[model samples]
Target chain A: MTDLEAGREALLDHVEALIAQRGGVSITLAELAAAAGMSPANLYRFFENKEALYEAVAERWFAPKVRAMEEVLASDLPIRQKFYAFYARRLGMICDDYARDPALFRSYLELGQQHIEIVRGFIDLADHFLAELIAEAIAEGYFPGLEIDSAVSLVNLMLQTFCDPELVVMLIHSVSEEKLAIVVDTIFDGLRGDRPSNVRRLTRAAR
Target chain B: MTDLEAGREALLDHVEALIAQRGGVSITLAELAAAAGMSPANLYRFFENKEALYEAVAERWFAPKVRAMEEVLASDLPIRQKFYAFYARRLGMICDDYARDPALFRSYLELGQQHIEIVRGFIDLADHFLAELIAEAIAEGYFPGLEIDSAVSLVNLMLQTFCDPELVVMLIHSVSEEKLAIVVDTIFDGLRGDRPSNVRRLTRAAR
Candidate 1:
């Protein structure tokens, strides 16, 4: 990467750490400038305002998440494995990122009209990727005779359930990682055309 | 209902309407009392404080939603129908309630710990109902050879998607009722055991 690109990334890292510590409420451009060892005027050369910096931070945080899914989508893995890996990676990234800096999560949630459309555009991109993946899976008989639209919606629902701020807050407070994994597995098992035999074994054990 | 019950219900209704109009930030007990043709001191007999009154108003609004789901669960409708009806009712209630009072939705989103617990309890109840319905559906061969736990999780995921605040906010702003209905229907179809022919028709139309 170019020196300027490296500097931009370093600035974003500093901003994310600060935002996480402050819960996205009290961020000031001066503080960010100081943290990045740059003058406020110099910082403005990179970002117009605090909000622009925030948008950059959000973009930086979400880029890896989208890239991870793209990697899974492009892999030669079976459709079920591809879908599961994509979602699991997404969920794990979110959980790990939130654990490292919950303020970033809070900031994303607080994004208003200025960023909402941009965020929605990214979401639409993800949705399109997912829809195509589902279509390909069904066409290849990896999932038997699945309806494309419903499958897309189901995947969207699954993503929402795992990423829901309220549910995630509660789950992180009281739920174990093992249990969360099981829940994710169960959700995918329902979505997939074929069920693993161990699913029955696990169900019986739970009972 | 008894006269006291009737009077209490009337007071709660007045308070809800006032809060709806005033965005829950400006409504005062005195104003509510005046609207109900009672003294502010008399209003105190019905609610201990503003928070308590707000909780009561929320309870009054949500009680029917709970009742409707409970009734569906208890009724003899097919599992698919029961699931569809439950979610349809839930989405409708959320949309209608938000239309009447956006503050009510905001308040619920910002609910304190005690209220969060109440909301969680409601979610757990719905989860249990979904589990039961899925179990029955599997037993009836609606989903032949289905994994029950996974199916239950998927159902929960579907329900959660409908109520996810972030997604709801986006949909409310950008989607029509017809589009929302399609979203709901597609999700349920995805969860259904077999691919329905109508999915292709819908997908083509959407394209």
Candidate 2:
């Protein structure tokens, strides 16, 4: 990478480190500059302010996960397996992230709400993929009555405790993948097709 | 009623009116006293502090609702209708309350979070009734594999958006009974006995 790209990389890394260490987005620009051994002016050259910097961090850190989820949706796995795979990856990653630095994950969530537009963009991306998956599930027989958007709404509502950052923070101590799996299973059961003979899709194509 | 009792009742009504008018729980005890034609010390004679007064409001305003839910639970209404009645009452009341005074409802949630013990007690009461309703559904045929607690967990998770006080505040402008009914129906469809012929309950008494 060029010298400018390298500097940008270092700045972003410092931003993450500072948020993790400070437990919130309340950290000062000066503190961030100090963490990176750079001047505030240099940081300003890279980002207009904290919101801009956070946007960049989200792009670097969270965007790839959304892309990966899209790939999961496009995979050759059955519908159930595709969902299970997506859940497993996310559940593991969130648990590990929380275990490594509980405060940082929380700070990220608080920052997302504070910078809601950036966060909503990220959520919309995730929602797009889930909407596709929900559509396929409906075609396959589950949620016979729901259109894609309504099904997505149900998923959002059902998983609010785990998916919502603020709610996650409130219930983190009691959260577990086992419990989450049960929830997923229950929703799928409820969504299961009541009429198998009318199934539209021949295979649960991942793609 | 005795004069002292009458005075306390008047003070509580004024508290509610002030909160509705002020659009928040940030109203001062002194202001509440003035609204009620009493001094702060006189207000203290009825209740020790603001939290205590809020607790009283919760008892008078909220506890009766919880008891009413219990009555619904014990009623011979179909499992589905019991869930429906509970959902309808809560969704209607919340929408009306939020529409009437958004800030007070938000402040109520904040206070509940701050005074978690009181909130927890309230939640437990609600959950106890939901648990019984879920158990009856399971015994009657729906949710074949779910135990009472697990089914209640799903109910809590699924209805969280429409039911959570804080979440309701966040979504109040967008909320409608139609959308809420969709959610309630979706959950009931999922909870509808997978094996209908084995249904044990026959009555769906409204009372």
Candidate 3:
């Protein structure tokens, strides 16, 4: 990378470390510069303002998560196993963030909506990955008599409590480890229910 | 009611109307007095400050809803039908609030957390009602092979997106009429899945 590019990247890294320590409030140019062992004026050379700096920090925060999730989606594991592994990784990441720095994680999530477009992009990207898995699950005859669209939204609702940082931060205590596993199981059971082997639930839609 | 009691009730009623008209911002002593055809000093006879007045307003807002919900819970409708009716009523009320006064609804929800104890109490009450239906559904052979505790939280997760005003405000368009019905169907199908007729998904907890 060019010197300027490297300096910009280093600045983003420093900002993230600071946020992990102090949440969103510490992103002032002076603090970031101090964290980087430089003057605020020098930091200004790399970024225009706090918002620009925050945008970069957000992209950095989301990069590895997106990559890991995409990897899980693209794998050839049986659909059920794939879904379990994906959420396991996601739940682990959230717990680690909260444990490592509860204050930062909470405040960041509270203010996270300020980066709405970025967060939306991540959710959209994750949704696209999950959509692929849902299609495969249906094709495998796992979700019999279910429309793909409905299944997609159902998965979104089922996973929202686990995946949304804002909700996670809010209900972190209420959603326990055992509860997560059980909800995942229920969703899978519901997805895989009503084959020739299981009892049939008369469709309310049909009624 | 005594003459003073009648005056207090009138202020609370006036406060609700104004909040529904202008949101939490309208609860200021001056605006409330102006809205109620009384002096600001006289208003202090009833409420100490905005916070106190808001707590009362919040309670008043939740009381009838809670009563109606308790009535729904007390009814002997079959579990499946009961669940549907409760959410339908809740969703309809929320949609009406959003439609009737989008600004007030938004502001109220934004400041809604200020009355955290009252809101939490309402949620706990509603949860108690839903818990009974969940237990009944399990007993009625509707949710075959599902744990009660897990089922309760699953029900909460499933209904949260559809009912949370904050989420509704954020994802109102994303959750369309057709999708809501379909998701509700999926939950039911999953509930009824894995009976003697279907090959049961072995409990993951066992594994």
TM-score of chain B of each: 0.64, 0.76, 0.75
Q: Give all TM-scores, in the order shown.
A: 0.72, 0.81, 0.81
Rank candidates, DockQ, best first: 3, 2, 1
Please give, as one word, the docking class of candidate 1.
incorrect
Error of 3 at B108 (Å): 1.2
lDDT of 1 by residue, A2-37 (tens): 877787788888876776666546567899899888
lDDT of 2 by residue, A1-207 (tens): 987778878888887887777665566678888888888998888777877777787787675577678777888766765665565456556666667877778888777767788878977888888888888878788777667886787677767676665766676665555556555555666553333311112111211
Q: List the residue pairs that clash in candidate 1.
A: none
- Give Cα distance to truth, residue B103, candidate 2, Å: 2.2
* Model 3: DockQ score: 0.26
The residue-by-residue lDDT of candidate 1 on B41-160, one tens digit each, is 888887767667666765775688879888878977655556566665677777776787677666555542335655565667777777777777777765443477656655455455
Q: Which residue pairs clash in candidate 3?
A: A197-B197, A197-B198, A197-B199, A198-B197, A198-B198, A198-B199, A199-B197, A199-B198
Model 1, position A143, has a per-residue lDDT of 41
For DockQ, candidate 1 versus 2, the one ahead is: 2
Model 2, range B1-207, lDDT digits (tens) per residue? 998778777887787777667554466688888888877887888888877777777776686577668777767666666776676577777778777866777767665666678678778888887887777777777777667876687677667777777887676664555555555555655543233211111111111
- What is the C-alpha RMSD, rounded to one decimal, of candidate 1? 9.2
Off by over 4 Å in 2: A20-22, A25-31, A173-175, A192-207, B1-5, B17-37, B49-51, B173-207
